[model samples]
Each structure stands twice: as C-alpha cells, then as structure tokens.
Target: MDLLPRKGITDDEIGGQVARIIELATLEEKIAMMSGHGFFEQIRESGGRLSAHPYRAGGGCERLTVPALYFTDGPRGVARGNSTCFPCTMARGAAFDVDLERRIGEVMGIEARAQGCNFSGAVCVNLLRHPAWGRAQETYGEDPWHLGEMGAALATGIQAHNVVATVKHFALNSIENARFKIDVRIDPRTLREVYLPHFKRILDAGCASVMSAYNKMNGEYCGQNRELLTDILRGEWGFDGFVHSDWVLGVYRAYAAAAGLDVENPEPIHFGAELLAAVKSGAIEPQVIDTACRRILTTLYRFASAEDPLDNYSIDLVASPAHRAIAHEAALKSAVMLKNHGALPFDKIEVRLVAVAGRLAIIANTGDNGSSRVWPPYVVTALDGLKDYLGDAKVVFAGDEGDSDAAAETAKAADAAVVVVGYTARDEGEFIPGDMSGDVRVEVPQKSIGGDRDNLGLSPDQIALIKTIAAANPRTVVIVIAGSPVLMNEWIDDVPAVMQTFYAGMEGGRALAKLLFGEVSPSGKLPFTVPASASDLPFFDRDAESIEYGPYHGYTLLEKSGIRPAFAFGYGQSYARFGYRALKARRSRAGIVVSVSVINLGEVAADEIVQIYVGFPGRMVDRPKKLLRGFKRVSLIPGETATLRFEVPLDSLRWYDASAKSWRLEPGTHTIYAGSSSRDDDLLRREITL
Candidate 1:
C-alpha cells in the first residue's frame, strides 16, 4: 500500500504529532485520555442500565482536539439510539452472503456515526463452540474459516466509513456463563488453526482496534496475556492498531500496559491510580505507558483526520426507511428453512384461515437487551407478520401459555397452522450474573441475560405443544426463533416443516411474513451443524471454572466421530429446486478455481449457496473429513442456469503442524466436494493432485 499524504495527516506527520502531544500533555491528561469520563455516572443516572444512546467508553484529549471515542456494543446494529436492527451475527452467518453482510456493515457504520459514535464494537467473530452457550447469537458460527470470511467482510465494510471497527472478545472467549472466571485450556496447534485464525483474518483486513476477552486463556486473563497481546497479535501478526480491554473488569492488573494492552475502557479501575502508582514505584516503566497511549492516539488520528462519511448524519438516518429495507433484506436472506415437506410457502397450500400460536408470536421480541440490544422504533411479531400478510383472510392467534389443549383445538380448526417456538431473553444470551442459582445478584452492568441454557432441547411444554399441534394439523409449520441451533428430536418428526428465523431483528416479522407467503424464497443455509444429540459435540460445561477446549467442534467433530447430524452445515431448502452440474477443478497461479453450473429447476426465482469442501487423501493424521474451503451464493430465475466459480487458496488447505509450529500442506491428493451442504451425498467430488 502507498503511504502518500491524503486529506488526513501523513505517516510522518502522525508520528511527529503523537510525540509532540505526548511531551506537551500532563501525565494525568494522558491517563485520562485512556478511559471514559462520564461512563459510570451516566449509567448511574439511568438507574443501573445504559440508556438508549451512545456512551463514552474511552478516549478524550481536549488539549489535542481528539474527540472522546464514543463506543457502542453490538454484532446486530449500533447498540444505541433507535438504530436499525439487522439480524444477529449468527443469522447473517446463516445467510452466507458476504456481499449482503458487507452492505449490512455499511449501514451499521453509517448509523453509528449518525448516532454520534466514531467507534463501534460491533464485529463479534467468536466461534459458536456450543449452541447452549448463551452469547452464541452474538458471533458468526462454529467454523473458523466461515467466521473469518464473514468477519473480514464486516470489518472491511465498517472501516470503509472510517468508523474504526473493533473486533471483540479477542481469543477463546466462547462460553458465556463463566466468562468472568473461566480459564480455557487448549493446545497451540488447535488454538492457532481453529480459535485464533478468525481474529488473524480480521486483523489482515486491517481492523482499527481489538477488545481483549474477559475470560482467561491458559492461566492468564486475555487482557494481560503477553503472548496473545504482544508476542502474537503485534509482533507476529503486525497489528499496528491499539488494543483495549473489555469494559469494566476486562483488565485485572496495573501491569497490563507491559503486556501490550493499549487502553482500559469505561471507568478504568485497574489502569488509573493503580497504574500511576506502579509507574512511580518503578514497578512499570514510563515507556510502557507512553507506548500504550501512543498506540491509542495514533489509531485515533488515523480516523479523525479522514473525511466524514456524509454531511450531517441526521437523526433520521437511524432506522430510516432505507435502513429498515436493508434490515428486511438481511432477515429475508438469513432465515434458513431447515426441513420442508411441501408445507411452506403458505400461498401454495390454498389456506384461507391460518392459526398462529406461541408466546413469542405477538411479542416485540428481538433479542436480549444486554450488551448487544438494539432498541428499535418498533418490532413486528410473527403473529403480526402473519396477520398482515393474510390481509382479509381469517387468522387466529392463541397464546395459552399453559393450555396446550386449547392451542391444539385452534390448530385443528385452521386451514393451516404456524407454530412459533424457541428461546427468548429469558432463556439464553450473554450471561452476566455470577449467581445462576435463580436468586440473582447483579453487581454491575452484565454482559449476559438469562445465562447459558440448561440444555439444547426445547422446553418440555413447548415440545408437548408442538407435538399436539402437529397431531391436530397435518399442515403444521414450526418456526424456530432462536439465536443458534435447537435440537428438534422430540417433535421434529411430528411437524412437516421447520424454519430457523434466528432472533431475526426489528423488521424480522415483515421478513418472516414475506418468506412464508412465497413473496421471497428461503435462501439461508445452516452456518453450523445441528447435531443428532448434544453429546456428539465437544464437552461443554458453561459453569466450569476451568475447561479444556478440544481441537474439533461443530460439523468437524461430528464428521470425525462418524456421527450423523440432524441437519448438516450448509443445508437449507427453498421453494425452487436447484441442480448442480459440470463440476470442474483446476490449479491456477491464484489458487484452485472450481467452477460449477447451478440451475433452478422450479418455477420460482431463488438463490443457491454452492459450498466446496476439500478432503485430504489418507487418514494418517487427525483432520476433519472435509473442511469448507470456499463457497458462493448465486441467484437464478425459473429454468435459469448460471456458472459460479470459487477461488480456493492453496494456503486455505494447509494443516497446522504443531511440531513444526507452522502451517504445512501435507503432500496428498486433495478431494474437492462441491454442492449444497457438508453431507457427502449432497456434493460432487473431484480430486486434484498437488
């Protein structure tokens, strides 16, 4: 990249300014710039919870004209004001549309700036190690490659507006319930290949900042882990941007500066007076403090001197009509129809009377209002969506919280029934409470909601209601409104169709209505595998104080053990059928180019996600039977055929050799599986020799 002077400061000028500012500023002013000023005071004024507006989390140097870094929490939307809430990151991952996700990132960045925030903590790329791990919705999915690609797209898009994007919960912070105290143990190879790869990808995309995770990796907290912050992220990866601790309690020691933590966010209990005392006592070097402050100021000026996104980002930009439409598009593409027996696309079934039953049907349920919450202007429920879509048709909605019999009777009477069931804030999401024994004691702002789920299965009552409804109505469709995969064994066989409409978003209801009525085809595919049983996944105990993280999880683990999943990763259904043909794979200077012709067989326009998984010949070493190397989403009309090409880099197929401590491409014939899902039967295989 060329380093010529643009409208902003030049590289030399930035360096000179940082040094000059450091010398001119008082020690107190430098430390003050490293933390929030009115953060806790504002929260206290709002009575314990942050108000629906941007909160000053860090950065303020009035002497140098450096604006206080106004930060907000999220992976959904700008978690402040009436921002347009798109689907959760998990939902966007399911969409598997990088371009769409980028566009979504653009809107989020635009809205964040409109809300007067220059920094965004919205790119959450943590791997979904377990479905029951409450904050699973905040991240992309279970696989590192998929998470990396999607996260990179988002980071790129957000930074396009010069809104310094921050990729958060830095390394191995998957579990929610015990995040504050959990110490995750993992081997170097597994950590590099599976867990840390995604973060590296985001850094490669030139993300402006990083927030250390709350949990400990190995024996040390992430905020103060010298190996992670200094040795790997800065020294090895060459991430020039600043690294900040997660808000409040994210930093455990005053010597965090020595470990490369550039800033302490929120009120900064650890890095304030304690840090000043440490410096005076010669326990910490003043050079370490200068380096930390310099990094923050350098990253700050990088965006501050750049051009503003647009003129006067008025309040109207937040959740405006155009943004809402983007939200609708996100929800439309993210809703994955997992199973269908010709029971979907309500218009095709000749239904005049419809029945909608569920506690979540008519509620303004978007997601947990913890750190990632977006208080939209309004939310449309599933019942509202169905009623609005059904217009003049008779629609019956029953929410007998405990009367399954009455709901069953209503289902029996309707022409077709849509049963909405799944977890809400009361069920799961970023667990903040240390006490999970029912008696709650909240000390400060919590990152979690109801905490990690008790189990993956649906509640007993919801299961019974689903079974009863399915028995009474042969044309029943189950709509799951969860953040992650929900095991559906108890009643999956009873229902003819199932759709995962993740905590869709503010405009989710409208999107759900559009999808069910054949106005739009369901194009989302499973980003993570839904296992036959929870036992098949890596052992996950959210409450465990210390946990060993294995190398494999999600589809990789299930495939390695030869255990079948309920629905394999990348599996989804559409009203329009798709056919794959003419599979070709060849090596190019760029990488392996795989081309395939996709045809829409049905009489409706739809999108098909073509996934390519590379399988190494021989089982001499531990490896996933196949790893997702590349994928593409193509749209086609009725009887339309389009050729889609995917570039799979040779590096993507390399293995992390623990002994060598580097990536190595084992010499073997690599088998490429090209088709819709991870299931072997669903793909067309072609072998390529290295």
Candidate 2:
C-alpha cells in the first residue's frame, strides 16, 4: 500500500515526490503538462466567455494523479460568473492600505477557489509608464516602490489560501495597442531600477508563477528572451516557478522553450506539435522539456497538496455579502476628493433637492469587461445609492438624452448639483480584438478595442455639461469615474468640488453615497500623478511597433522638467484636516525610521496617507527629484493623534549601477521628506546622512 503516489499529500512532502512523479511521467505526458492542453478549445467552446465552470489550463497528469490547474484573471476580483467585483487595482493602490489589500487578496482567493480556480492570474504589477496606457487601471501605480509593496501584499494574500498567484507581463509590457509587436528599448539602469523591481518584489514574496509579456524587450519577444526569462528571472533572482506565456499570442516560436518559458497558456499554438517537432529535430533538448514540466508539476503539487482542491467549494461563496462589503470598503477608501469648496457631505435636511446629472449616475459602471469583468448579482448605480441613502430627500436625475440647456435649467432649482463623469470599458481596458478572437494572429475586427487612450481629457460634451451645470448652480460637485488619471484643465475651475472615484467595484455607488453624505470620509489618494497638461508627461505612442523607454515618467518626468502637476502623486483630501508635526529621522538596525505625529485638526474623523520620500543627493548620475520609499494609511478620529513610523529600507534607496550591473546605495546626506503627497513644498523635510 504505497499510498504516497495516489492520495494528495501536504506541500512540505512534495519536494521528493515531485521528482518521483516526474520520473514516472512519459515524454508525451511531460510535454502535455508543459503547456495548456485544449485550453483555447475550451474557451472557444464556451464562446470566449469566462465562467465559474473550471477550464483546466495546465498541470494535470493522470499517470501521476496530479490535479489540473484551473486559472482565471484578476486584481479586482475573480474573472468568472457572478463574482464580487472589487475596486480596480488602481483604486486599491489609491487606498494605500496594504492590510486592506491583503484582505482583498484573501477574499479573491476564496472566491477564485469557490469558482473552481486554483490558480489566480491576478497580481498585475506592470508599472504605469503613462496614464494613457489603456490597461493603466490593471496595475497599481507608476512608482516601482509603490507597485512592489502593493503587489507583494496582494501576492502574499492570494497564496495564503494555497492558491497559486501569477505575477504578470514579466518585463516592460505597458503599452497596450502594440503589445504583441512593440520593442521597448530601455537602458539597463531604468529596466533594473524601475521596470523590473516590482516583479522581483512579487517573486520575493514567492509568487507561484510568472506570465511573460507579449511585447519584445530590446527587440526580443519577452516569452522568448533568454536574458529576461533565463538570465534575470530564473538565474539572478532565483524564480523557481514555471514561466508561462501570455494568453493567445504570447509566443510566436516553438523554440521559446529554449528561452526558459515553461508553459504556453490558453492554447498550444506555438507549443504542442511544433514544440514536439523541435525537440525531435535536435532544436531543443528533451531535458529542457523535462525541466519545464518539472517546474510546472512541482509548483502545482506544492499548491494543490497544501489544501483541499478548489473543485469541492460551493459557488455561493463567489459574491457573498461579506465579499461585497469589501467592495464597498474599497470604494469608500478608493475615492479621491480632488477639490472641495464647501460643497461635499450633502446634508440630508439642508440639501433637499439634489440634481444628479450625467448618464453615468444611473449606469452600473464597474469597469472594463475584458479579462477582469465580474458579473455581480446586481450593480448599485449612483442614482440607486443616492436614492437609497437620501430616503426623504429628493434626488433628481437629469439624463444625457435631453438638451444641455434644459438639463442646466432643471439643475438651477436644486440645492446642489452632482455631475458624474469619466471613461468606461469603451474608453480603456485590456486590448483585445473587437471580435473577441480565440486567435490573435487573425486581424482585429475593428480599431483598437482596448488600447492606449488617444487623449487624457474628458469629452467636450461632458465638459460642456459640467460648465452649464456649474453656471446654473453655484454649488456643483463633479465626480469623475475613470480607471486612471484624467486632465482637468478644461473645466476644473468651473466645478466647486471634484472627486475621482475610479471604476469602484460593484458597491461603488453605495460607497459614493456614503462619502457624499458624510457617512464615510474620502480617504483615497492619487496612485499616479495628474499632469497639469498631457504634454508634460512622457512621449507615448500606443500604436508604435518600437519605442525607447526612458528612466523617468509620471511625477518623475514632471519634476525633472520643472513642470508642476495638476495634482501630485499620493495626494488626497478628507472631510477633516490633518496636521503633520514632530518629524524626526533616525537610523535603525532595520533601516532609517522616520516618525511623525499625525493629528486630525477638524471636527470630523478622517484618514491620512503618510508618504515618505528620500531625496537622493545629486551626484554621479541624474536621479529622480525624490523617490517614494514607504507609505502608510492611518485612520484618525476627531481630535485624535497617532505617531506613524515608516521604516526606510536602504536597499530600496539604492540605485542600479550600469557598470557593475548591480544596485549601489550611495552614502550621502539624504533629505527625508514626509508629507501627504509628492509635492515638494507640501513636504516636511529633515536631513540625515546614510
């Protein structure tokens, strides 16, 4: 009775068993397990729709009794039927609450498992190189440190339940439109310091897998780039997990196996028979195939054996009330109050007649329906939330169908006008074919479905509507519903108050109602810098097949060019005021500890994002004005004070030296700036030598 080979064992006992199982596995079984078998066929059978039903993507060996890995897309929520849709990753990043993100990860893991998915492809840490990057909403932010910390929290949370977490778009795969064809030529320093740090952080957290980017890095496809897949990821960083290709058109050549890609996902377009032929023709070694299979099998066994397999879970856990509450909490925390001129916290009795303008107010506007789509039981619209909250108070709605003048005339009678505006799935998301192709080689049905935005401004009609409403009603609050930053130069001055509620999850509307009525304070900060003008940011060409990536973007570029941002990164305001005082920095064994007392000065309770930036001494090479090293979100009640201590890791402060191809922390008098945002003048600084 050698039961070790049949029954599922614990993760600790999988090391020796993995080799034994691999030895028992034949060449066909190993190759079959290396890539996703019949993956695209399953999607095609399902009409290219994602559902709760399990679609085995990889790692099932009948001979070895290895369970298949059921994977799904994520970051917001599980990408399946009737799943709880949390706020977008950008929204979570704005919250700056790592603990909350971990909670989200835990719930995501539960739901993903409930949906019969054991592998979650959710940890999207691709840096937001530009705000216009269509899939900007999927990632955390532009800063490497912020993305790393946030992604690490998410990866850690997902793996807690024994679900495999996949950190994606391995190298620089920011651009959306030309992702399949673009060559991002970046300097070694920029690639190491900015582009790749977040992925490394996720790997350090022991993410189960890495999804190679579709784009080419320095003229080589990421899936087939040995320097990226083998040298950096596997060799240098010691990522032992299997590396999979992006869905559909991830790899173009079968020899990608030689490049260190362990799995070809969704389908075996480039793998399967082509890969078999290569191996038989001496183009690839059988040992390489064995290595790939072993990696995949080992990782799968580690996760599958750690807990009961996901297929046994009930579907009721997908969008449970508790899970929806997390969505509400995310929405509450993700809202960034851009401007408030005594117009927010709508008094129930005082503000009787409220006009909720724009079509977005009534729509169930979650986000893109590409890969991260979550079909909640019901979506709470802004109108629904307001109506639910303001029971006796009259909340009027002015649809976009009517004439602008008529809408404005109606708004004049209201005590205050709240206009909901901004983009949806039509404007941004994961770039896919208009036809939703099973194969990417086929031409896109139409123009870019999900690609980099051509512009960063609101629609002219929306601008006109806001201006009209502002002129009619002295009290007007503009709420922007977008995934990323939007330039507000056109009509920012017209509106009295402005809020950026990124595609907040299923309960976003309810959360919006709470923030508007002062039930909860607006606590979310800007994850990316809002440029005063789009021209101030880096050059972005979404359709360009090849481009050069610079070391600086977002706030770094704006600061370097001496251009002021419309709203700096990590900037957000609450209903109440917070004062930062008693700032001190001292070196500790862990690293430099920067402690500051944050006191809520206003009568209302609120939350504050304490951001710590290290101003590296200008010397050997050009550096960012200041880099975000650490941040924490602290909640405070009225008149309450808390001492926030942020540990400044010396390793994070190190700059990548191109000559040595290693990170070097220069010893100098570094200025530690503590503030609510990245604005230089707003920060309280103390000089310290490291």
- TM-score between candidate 1 and the true structure: 0.95
lDDT score at residue 301, model 1, on the 0-100 scale? 72
Error of 2 at 277 (Å): 1.5
Model 1: which ten-residue window has the lowest total lDDT?
434-443
Q: Listing every candidate in turn, what is its Cα RMSD in Å to the true structure after a full C-alpha superposition?
A: 3.3, 2.3
lDDT of each: 0.84, 0.85
- What lDDT tens digits, residue by residue, belong to model 1 across residues 515-621? 98889999999989999988888888878999999888998888889999999999999999998899999988866899988899999999889898998865556
Give the clash count for model 2.
Answer: 0
Q: Compute each candidate's TM-score over C-alphas.
A: 0.95, 0.96
